[model samples]
Target: MEFRLSEDQRLLVETARKVGERFGSAYWRDLDARKAYPAEAWQAICDAGLCAIALPEEHGGSGLGMLEMALAVEALCAGGAGSTLAQLFMLNPIFGGVSIARFGTPAQKRALLPGLARGEVTFCMALTEPDAGTNSLEVRSFARAEGDGWRLNGRKVWITAVPQATKMLVVARTRRVEEVQRRTHGITLFLVEPDRPGVTHSAIEKLGTNTLPSSSVFLDEVRVEPEDVVGRVDEGWPALLEVLNTERIVTTAGLVGTVELAIRLAVDYARGRRVFGATPIAAYQGLQFPLAQAHALGEAARLLNRKAAALCDLGEPYGSPANQAKLLAAQAAAQATERAMQTMGGMGYAKEFDVERLWRDARLFRFAPVSEEMVLNYIAVHDLGMPRGY
Candidate 1:
């Protein structure tokens, strides 16, 4: 299958590149230090219409495909804007807008999509519970009938964007696990305002990605009308998996970009830092070879990412490629960041060079959204025809 981008798609990447570089490195640095949101950068992304990507045009979107959306994300990261800066798009564009476009009812779409497309509505998905990290089906959050609506009660940990989010997409169990034939059953999705009477959130202190905070969310009898539901009740597993695949593909693309940025930063530093008075450290094969390997790794992951994204847009099964792309891209970013730090030596440890920050950010992709071990398990069972290990 051909992977050449159309002129418009190419232009979209270019536009995103400009937007990503406009803030410069200092913008991200300050935000990381202060642990504050990149409010101005988010506004710039909104003003540039990047937030409208990958949604139906009738809902104030750009009518682009997932491939284009992934490309936009990659460009943003490659322009020296790291993953955290690009996460603004993830909340509204991928998780909120695209998912709603796929599964939301007409009324629900009309109520939320336009605001999401405009970046006015930010959504934080509450899926990971303290007890259910990799095993999302084990989530114990439940919603029960209450008058004409449902009352939800549960706790979610490590949910991102809770402070900035106006709406929380909650996943709750409608039946006990024993009542369901499959773990995928009895689950439902609901949208609730985070500032509701019974909802509270506390930020988690993390090592990196300080610009966007992840939180432990508490839900106690949060009430929601039927209109708040997305897709069918007790059938949210497919929808949830689809959103995870979308996230893996697009974020994999961003991870590849981080790999590229880290290599570039290291290379620039290596060329200038003289090791033996006259010879620059770039002459050392140790530093140069690892970056080269990382570049090749990122390139391969980028190809797989594009293929998976195209498959998604074509309505084909892409879980295998998506998982594979995420695995490699996450590794590539982590390796590149580590090498970048080593090449820069003491400067790398210091936040001024940005390698340390990149290292911290890159490390997260290895586990979050999905872990490396889980991806291997998936490939072994689903792709390699091996017996289930987990």
Candidate 2:
């Protein structure tokens, strides 16, 4: 199998790198310090049309697939933007935009996709409730038919970028879980405006990745029109699964990028640091092996990520590979950042080096979108014919 990136993919990597460089470490560090958003970097991304790479040409995007989008996001991470860039660009444009582009009606597409492509609008997924977490079937949010539309009431927690999002795709139970033969059924997707009469949100303080705010969104009798439903009613499980896989792949790509950055920082410090007066720390294999091992793991994670994204683009079953990639990539990012900290000694812990920020952000991947445990459960049950665990 060919491993080389095509010319277009290479260009995408280069362009993304340039965008990341244009923002630089100082830009990201300042945002992290104040728990502020990456507004400038996002505006730059929008001006460059990076938000629409995965969108169809008819929808005013570059007509690229997920693999290409993953490549760009990886570059963004590698160039020092880290997880913030993904929250600003990928979370909405790739994950939320793809759902609408693929399933929305003609009118829906005409009204939404163009604005999303132009970066004038952004969408956030409101799937995770305080109680649901990974157990989507446990979502207590419910919606009922009202006149020509639906009325929704629910609470969503840990929603990324909700404050900046113009719209949200909320998953709610249209029928009681006990009434449905399968728990995954009875769930429906709704595209709702966050500024409506009954919709309100409060910013949630998270441990890391503060460049994009997390929020708790309250939907109290919010109304959604009939056309806002994505895919078939009570058939949102499959559609949500697709969106999850896409999110995992892109999130893995971001982790891989962060790993690359960590390795670079560690190696650079090792080469320049002099402890014995006459020799550099790079002379010691003790410092070298861990960084080398982290590099190897990052390389492997990148390959798995590419494979998963390729499967997604080909319309093939990619659930197993996508989960594997995300699990491994998250592990690699955590290991690489930890190793970088070890290699740099105390400097890695300092905010100036920026390894601390990456370390914190990398830890989130181990538990979010889908946890490592949940990924393992899925692999065992779906791929290995094992009995369900949870």
lDDT of the candidates, in the order given: 0.86, 0.85
Residue range 1-390, candidate 2, lDDT tens digits:
779999988988899899988887778888899988777787777677778888878878888888888898898888887755776655677556878888777787888888887778888889999888999889999998899778899999998888788888898998888888899899888888778889999998778998888889999999888888998888888888888888888888889888898888888888899988979898799988887888888888889889998988899988888889888888888889998998899998999998899999888889988999999999899989999966
Instruction: Report the Cα RMSD per candidate.
Output: 1.1, 1.3
Estimated TM-score per prediction? 0.98, 0.97
Best by lDDT: 1
Model 1, residue pairs in steric clash: none
Question: In candidate 1, residue 323 scores what lDDT?
Answer: 95
Report the C-alpha displacement of residue 26, candidate 2, in angstroms. Answer: 1.2
N/CA/C clash count, model 2: 0
Where does candidate 2 clash, by residue pair? none
- Tens digits of per-residue lDDT, candidate 1, 1-390, equal 776888998899899889988876777888889998877877777778787878788988888788888888888887776766556666777778766899999987888888877668888899999899989999999998888888889999999989899888888898879898999999888888899989999989988888889999999988888888899988998998888888888789889889888998999999999968899999999889999999999999999999999999999999999999999999899889999999999999998898898889878888988999999999999998999856
- The weakest ten consecutive residues by lDDT in model 1 span 81-90
Say which candidate scores most in TM-score: 1
